[model samples]
Target chain A: MTKPNEFAPAWQVAEAIRSGDVPAEDVTRAALDRIAALDPKVNAFTDVTAERALTEARQVDADRAAGKTLGPLAGVPMAAKNLFDITGISTRAGSKINRELPPAEEDGELLKRLSAAGAILLGGLNMGEYAYDFTGENDHDGACRNPHDTARMAGGSSSGSGAAVAAGLVSLALGSDTNGSIRVPSSFCGTFGLKPTYGRLTRYGTFPFCDSLDHLGPFARSVRDLALAYDVMQGPDPRDHACANRPAEPALPSLNEGISDLRIAVLGGYFSTDGMPEAAAALAPVAKALDADKTIDADGIDAGRAAAFIITNCESSRLHLPNLRARADDFDQDTRDRFLAGAMLPASWYVRALQVRHWYREMFAKLFETVDILLAPATPFPAPLIGQRTIEIRGKEMLTRPNIGLFTQPISAIGLPVCAVPVFSGEMPLGVQVIGAPWREDLCLRVAGHLEKEGVAVAQAPSGF
Target chain B: MTMSDDDFDSEAFIRTMAPSLGLSLDEERVAGVSVFLSIAKGMADILDAAPVPENSLELASVFDAGQTAQQAKAE
Candidate 1:
């Protein structure tokens, strides 16, 4: 029997429930009990849907007893970043602005699908306000501290989702990635996070930051679990215009295919030049595992990053223009200032950015003809301390918020599938980002799994969980 | 497209543009806007140094056409 306190993968938990070795209700009870005892210190959940989770677990138990069909995720407890709408709960979106908004009449499409698949909703988690900043330091709601070391920051804006899963409070959780929201937290909190190809997962009812860049995905302790959750959440929704009108591809079956013949590349230049020795050091084993070839020049990367920033800021400003005009003071100083800067950008500049985006995408397409996946550091460095404004990297000082997404922003700009795998360097956690061509989530996961199997990266539950 | 350093603190320019753009700007809001404008102005200066292509066309519809092609393929 798996120890109650030990970190059990979601698939293992599901199998245990299926085999009747452990009842779904008993597992749910244990999870809730763990959350009840551990969450106050971890602050993983903003709301604990204890009553609803229990009621749902009971239904799963009743269904199992009747020999009814079980969903793939049957009776697993999961949470969404607070930005997602859970029927009857106001989607605060980690900001005070939406606090008084009416409760959602229906669960977001993602939530509804996950629930239909038999995953219990444990409630919404915390995030960076408006999902703007990368650091999980929420001023309105207290900053979600890193579970590994309380003084450190949980990478944002899916801070709580990352911390909760890493701390073993939940096996699976939903996180939105716009400029590495999911990947950063997963990297910092030491877990596996997947930012599927843009439009692969429906974004209906989820709050928008930058419609073009915003991607909804999963964070889990294992790559397989992330793939399982992603497979369930995928499929076109008529409601989301960005969603691709295609049938969902099976991600799990491909995970077992292995990466023997895959053409892998170590993204050099921009990816290799920056920050902490640990960040660069974490990539060596991944490169060796994949026998990755060096590619990607540094010249165009800055332009890619600049274009992504311009698009993110301009669209974000447009989204918040009304509130920014009405209640500018209500936002955190950082988010407010960034929005203000975005609002001042000229229309022509934004237009030029779009043109540049086209050129960059074509450039990536040319590169992908030779390589199936590109591996790079997820963040320039590991999670910095909360409230840190500047960090020293390679003897040069760098801004924390904007630079953290240096490697991540460029890839997301092109709408690639990226899985951030946490590599343990000594006591701290660092991550290597594996990016695949558009709609190649399975390839990304396969490569990530290869890294895990080869011991290139290891996932560990945060200490004192 | 070139802007001088003085453009960073163009409070009067921002105040005039704010209401025209439907933005709120009280004294405090003006101060915030000023700081932001400074950063934008700095970034804008850097961005302006690069020359634009004479035949540069807007790329918004690039994805739109590709999306249509993809949808047609799916059908």
Candidate 2:
């Protein structure tokens, strides 16, 4: 009976449990114990389902005794951002308003997929209110602290998802990325995150913020773990009308394929890391390691980013109009103010923004025709302090909330698949987005895998975790 | 849709539109919401300035009833 290492990647953990080196119950208990001990500091898990987790782990053991074939993720523990329903619990979606909603009768589509693939549910993690945030600060559940530095942010709406994985509380986490929710946390927490193409995964059974711009993804310690989770969750669900009518395209099979002849380039101009030395430093190593020398520009980037902001504001505010009208005072001041302003945006502005989105989508479609992958910084800088509001970039002070997503929003606006791979430099780690064309998630993952193998991108645990 | 007019009043727009949309704008939050609206206005201006060729684009539609119905039938 070997002790279960909580910090091991999901692939290794699953292999250990399958080989009888570690019992499923021990692995599950280890994660639960870690969450109980450290979650008070990280504030990652909003709810920990210890009893249910042990029951599920025992079933895995029982199946092994009967010689039944186990799933790939058998005996591995994982958690989802609270936005995903976990049956019998109120899907808080990181807002006080949703806390009063009826408990979900069933799990979300992604959770169900992960469960069927042999992953044990460790309950819901914390996030920003209604997934309408970049920083993981929630008025109801308190700020999700960065695992690296407890005083700083955990990059959110998937705040808990990233923090939980980085803190070794869980092997993998599920998160939603509307405009960098997954990537921001991944960058700040130094985890490998995948924001698959919009419509790549079904959005059914989860609370949504900007329906037009919202995306759901996974965060993990290793690139292979990210790909493994992604492979199982891929497929169309009729429940979510926005989900693409496409079959599952597994990236795990080709994950080891080296980037031999893939045309790679860095996005210049709009993605210029001018005056932001940390981001520039992070991208330089990734570009050099990949032998990527070409620098290209996407003309529609400015318009695309602007369009994302307008569409997000319009759609999210409209979705919460009823609550805004009835319980406006109950909402977080920052979230409430933004939604209120969003509601006032003219329909004409929204319509134009969508047109710009269409234009931007085509622009990327063309850009990918020449290059298989494009490289850019995931965040303009590292994670900011939890309560800090403003940051200075290029000698000009700007709002931290909106500015944090500058690099991420434009890419997600057109719904491209991007993998944010962390590059450990100085004290705090930064991330670089290895972006790919629509539905070419394998390319991004493959590059990330190469970087991980070369030690260029790594998810090193924070000290004393 | 252009925001060329420098005299546009964000507070006035909020006062008028919030009531129309059934959202009550409290005085304290009004100033805060107005600042957000002003930020949104700046972003909108960027979209206005970009030259989007007419023939190459359309609104990115999330729902297509006919296409969805056909896909469901096929499946």
Candidate 3:
């Protein structure tokens, strides 16, 4: 008999439940018990939702008993970054002030979709304040500790999503990626994450960050879980105006199509791991496995990263302008200073940044003609120690927070689909970004699925989990 | 459009610009805000140096205009 292991992949858990080997309620309760015992050390969950999780799991069990069809993910446990509205709970986008607001009347669209697919909602995970941070440290809620070391950072703004999934409290979780929030945490926490093409998933019922760049996606122990979750959640909603009207093209069925005929290349210039040996080491094996020898550059990436930064600043600052005036003192100092600076940006600069974004997107469109997929380091290095301010790269000390997303910001700026896969090649697991052209998330996930099958990329649960 | 460090002062810009936007900065907050503005200025300068074609347009649409354009293009 297969015993219920919280660390098992979501697909396996679903299969176990479907086979009647384990009850959904038993699995959900085990997850709740794990979170209760481990979350104190990891700080991954902001809310537990134990009662609701048990009720939902019981329904799944009753349905199976009645010969009703079970959904693809019929009883797996999952959580969302706190930015996602959880119906009666206030959406605390990692800020203290938002906690005082009224409870959300409806759950976020993604959460509803996942629930419909029969994934039990464990609760909301912690994140960087207002999703402005790349580091997982938050002031209102304590810094989400890395499960691997516990002393290190969990990466942000989806810190809790990555940590919870990596720590095996949930088989998979939802995270928002606006400038590498999903990828950074995945890279640091050793999990597979997908940042689908911007507007591919509905962002309705989620707290606003930079509307221009925000994307919601999944972090899971395996690429199949990422695709399964993404497949079920794919569709257009009138609620999120940015959501594309295109119908959902399921990536799960085509995940094993393999990359035999597709042209793959390594992103060289801006995506280079110049001073980061850990990232270089992580990418080398994956590159060798893919037989990708061509190193290409996407020109004007500096401008792309810069434009992304400016757009993020201007848009997010404008969104929080009222808060800055009334409750500036309430925000984490790290988030507050950046917003303060963003508010001072002249209209001309914001316009110019958008113009640069257009030009940059054109550059990527041309680059994709030659290659179907691109590979780059998901983060410069593994998770830095929690609260460690600066890190030395190439003998120059740089602020650890902003630099963590150096490779990620440029790609996300143009709204490309990327799958960040954890490679456990060293003392600490590192991640490599399998990037595909706009709307080609299938290619990205397929390549990652290939890597996982080949054992070049794998998400190992943190030691002692 | 490349702003030389000699050409712009982030501290002075914040000191003057914050009030115009109805943002009040405490005396201690000015330096921290300047740090990020300076970083933004550096990035803005990079964007300025990059050569964009004359036809390269900004990526925003007025309200539902983008959605309407997409629908029209599809039809």
RMSD list, candidates in order = 3.0, 1.7, 2.3
Chain B alone vs. reference chain B, TM-score for every model: 0.62, 0.72, 0.70
Runs off by more than 4 Å, candidate 2: A1-4, B55-57, B67-75
Model 1 clash pairs are none
Task: Go through the candidates in order and give each one's C-alpha lDDT.
Answer: 0.82, 0.91, 0.92
Query: How high a TM-score does candidate 3 get?
Result: 0.97
Runs in model 1 lying further than 4 Å from the true structure: A1-6, A293-295, B1-13, B26-31, B41-53, B61-75
Q: lDDT per residue, candidate 1, A384-405, as tens digits? A: 9989999977678977887788
Residue A273 local lDDT, model 2: 92
Provide the interface RMSD of candidate 1 in angstroms, 1 decimal place: 4.1
Model 3 stretches astray by more than 4 angstroms: B55-63, B66-75
Q: Model 2, residue A338: what's the lDDT?
A: 93
Candidate 2 lDDT, A253-366, residue by residue in tens: 999998997999999999999989889889999999999999997797989999999999999999999999998988987699999999999987898899888878887888
Model 1, residue A85: distance off in Å is: 0.5
Residue A388's lDDT within candidate 1 is 93
All candidates in order of lDDT, best leading = 3, 2, 1
* Candidates 2 and 3, the one with greater DockQ: 2
**What TM-score describes the B chain of model 1?**
0.62
Better of 1 and 3 by DockQ: 3
